[model samples]
Target: MKPSAFEYHRPTTPEEAAELLAEFGDDAKVIAGGQSLMPMLNFRLAVFEHLIDIGRLTDLTGINHDSGSVAIGAITNQATVGRSALIRTSVPLLSRATPLIGHFPIRNRGTLGGSVAHADAAAEYPAVALTLDAEIETLSSAGRRTLPAAEFFIGMWTTALRDDEILTKVTFPIREGRSGFSIAEFSRRKGDFAMAGACVAVKVDNDLRVESCSIGLFGLGSMPIRATSAERSLVGCSIDELQVRDVAHAAVSGLESVPADLHGSAAYRVRVGATMVARALKSALEEATDD
Candidate 1:
């Protein structure tokens, strides 16, 4: 099925695009890369009378890294991210998660903003953002405002972005000291969405004990979930004394609203999610200790 007829609006500037959305209100939608939105539109799952295409805004297309943070322009494609030395060195967790996002061809056209804004339960970028406490920056008539990843994602396929707001960039704070990151997931095929997955970032002390840890789960909940309790449990624990399976279990133990579908029962998803967390946590710990 084709999308319903709609006005095609190509706004050269983000401010102009935000204005279009502000004017069109509920009838308008912002589109960049269009990988996710186009599929929904083709399926008639979402319909809008106006498409505010900010694909060429230029203002949102690069990677910037400072000592403390890494800011990726919203329109930067996943392929660029994968090849980015800055991203790999400064935000290694993001780099590791990049290849896991669909296939190379999809990554070529899928914008970072599109993936995050679309907020798919199984997407890698959102999980990475949540794990890193990244800040999402937006532009609107009200001017600029930054929303932390924790507050940016509200529910499945929804965000805190206002009608007039255009996401311009996402900034991730660097993890200092000895850090390691890993992501683990189970998918039906190489390019298919994960049935369950976890992204782990860990910082260890010189004694090889956990100083801090962040685990972000995807494909098992309504929104990207931060396994905060599990993180707290691992603090100060030596790698040799840590039981990865137990921590993984704790991560999923408190989870509610995990989705159940033909892919798996809610129980099955929980099991898979826990296993992913275990695998990711183990790999991250190994990396941290090696460093």
Candidate 2:
């Protein structure tokens, strides 16, 4: 199947892209890499009257790190991210999770902003963004504004970005001190979307006691969710004394809606999700202790 007929506008600059979006309003959709959008369009799951192509906008493609965080330009592709030493060093979780997003061909054409903005519940980047509490930056003719990751994703395949707004950058705070991160998921194959998955970030003291931990669960909710209940339980416990399985249970305990489909039942997905959480937490703890 082919996408519905639409006008394509290839903007040379981010501002020009924003102007095109503003002009077309709800009828326009930005295409960068088009790895995700093209599939949806081909299936007719999504339709737009105008496709404002930002894939070639160099102004929206780069990686920069400051004192506190690293900001990645929206058009930066996943293949670049996977190879970037800065991303691997500054945001290890993201780098580690890169190959988990489909296969290399998809990653070669998939953009960071496109994935985050697509907001797929089972995607690794969204879960990592939530786990790291990254900041999402957007631009419009009106002005620019930033939003916390938690507030940025409001629903399935939906975000807080307005129709006329363009996502310009995503900033992830640097993890310093005793920190470790890991992501785990259960899929049919290496490139398949997880039936359930978890992204874990941990900060521990010298004695191997937990200082702070974040568990972001995906594929078990309407959006990627922070396992707050589970996190609260682990923050004060020693790794030796803590029950990894118990923490994983707590991670899925607070979930209200775990969608059941032909893929799996709600109970089955929650169980898989819990297992992934346990695997991720254990791996993260090992890394943290090694530090």
Q: Scored by CA lDDT, what does every candidate get?
A: 0.92, 0.93
Mark the 10 consecutive residues where model 1 has the least summed lDDT: 282-291
List model 1 lDDT by residue over 213-267, tens digit each: 9999999888899989899999999988999999999999968898988878999
- 1-291 in candidate 2: lDDT tens per residue? 999999989999899998998999989999999989998999999999999999898889999998889999998999999999999988999999998999999999999999999999989999999999999999999989999999999888899999999999999999998899999999978899889999999999988899999999999988899988789889879889989998999899968778888889999999999999999999999998884
Angstrom error of the Cα, residue 204, model 1: value is 0.8
Q: How do all models score by TM-score?
A: 0.98, 0.98
Please state the error at residue 270 of candidate 2 in Å.
0.5
lDDT of 2 at 107: 96
